[model samples]
Target: MQQHPFQISRKIEYGMRAMIFLASQPMDRTVPFREIARRMDVPEDFLAKILKTLVERNMVRSTRGAHGGYALARPAREVSFLDVIEAVEGPVVVNVCQDGSSHDSCKATGSCTMYGVWKLGQQRMLEVYRHATLDRLAMSDLRVPEPAPEAPTRPAAESRRVE
Candidate 1:
């Protein structure tokens, strides 16, 4: 059987998508869970569970009533990607050693050379995620915005002329 590389799963994808949708909404507005679920095409129950976790972590606030729903407790720029991920999925440690949960039964406790490499990579990933706020992510586009027009400035000898 082929071994699959460990990475963020579909749940994380759906959760992030749902969060981006929330971020897109006006800050003053509290979106209904059902509406978010429908718009994001995520299972209502699953998204609700994720939202509950976010609420517990104080990343989001929820209200109870006919008009009550969910909204970010603070500005999107104040919330980091790591906050959301950690709220729903717990800490992003890759190994038991990093989590300090190693047991005596484990044979490779102190002999793994790759552990150091993994720890370094993990730290970098954490820093990137922690520094990347939801506001930045919500505005992330691979292409640059339109550039201003300007006259060409180059010597005739160095620049190619149009046919």
Candidate 2:
């Protein structure tokens, strides 16, 4: 399926999911990648890459050996959604015009038809993502609801409909 232009990449999504899971845990505790993958329904291999990036960015800390795992590098409130996103996917620019300075080609503000709308929207997007931290997300109840478990349904037998 075609993705929306504004949609974040899976790496970003999984990275944030892992972050929230880590944040939910006690700060001092290091949880294993297997656990994180299971809980978040993310692929372990892919999650490993995302966590490595986070570790490199100092947003997450990792430990080796059997007793080791991963944990947040700082308090959840100290890390913003933008921080995780930029860490995983580089700067989050909505458009080329949203980046650069006065006129390094595609300036921040412009006279193009979509420039004003995209610029204003980009500014708002930046502000929202910058201020919306992990702790704040944890406090909010906006998670996708888990689907209810259902009993397995048996296929109709050949004679079931025959009176």
Candidate 3:
């Protein structure tokens, strides 16, 4: 069987992480690519490409000079997750039938059994992502401490017999 088709691309993941790191910095502060790459553990070239796309999308600003760096084009709170993800991954098409158009309904498919389910699920997903801004994410990251590295797990024992 084919592997699941719906998976979050690594580009989107890295872009989001980079944004969070940038958002954690002061609004007026600009962070160099090297610093962001090191802190986020993303490859500098890969991150640069992602940042370039984000800059083109107007979600991030890039400066070139001896002390040049990157910063958000607007307040982190104003930049939604949808904006970042869309910049990296294009629109979020949860399913084949979830295209954004007036004529894009189950009617087009004639008889899709899961139409209602897909419609509701896709809308909820969009709403969640649309409202989830970087500021809220950064605050949550600040409040929560990073968990320690997990130790290697021991082998599982056989189940015991019931009495």
Identify the candidate with maximal lDDT: 2
lDDT of each: 0.77, 0.85, 0.84
Give me the displacement of residue 57 in model 3, in angstroms.
0.3
lDDT of 1: 0.77
Estimate TM-scores for all models: 0.74, 0.79, 0.78
Evaluate residue 3 in candidate 3 and report its C-alpha lDDT on the 0 to 100 scale.
42
lDDT over C-alpha atoms for residue 94 of model 3: 72
RMSD (Å) per prediction: 11.8, 12.5, 15.5
Q: Give me the runs in candidate 3 sitting further than 4 Å from their true place.
A: 1-3, 102-108, 139-163
Candidate no. 3 TM-score: 0.78
Worst 10 residues of 3 by lDDT: 138-147
- As a TM-score, model 1 comes out at 0.74
Segments in model 2 whose C-alpha atoms lie over 4 Å from true places: 107-111, 139-163
Best by TM-score: 2
Which segments of candidate 1 are over 4 A away from where they belong?
1-5, 100-110, 139-163
Tens-digit per-residue lDDT, 1-163, candidate 3:
5546677788999999899988887877788989889888899999999999999999999999988999889999898999899999899987777787643555657666787787899899889999999998874542335579999776555355557
Residue range 5-89, candidate 1, lDDT tens digits: 5678667777787777777666777888998898778999999888988888888888889988988888989888888888778
Candidates 2 and 3: which is better by TM-score? 2
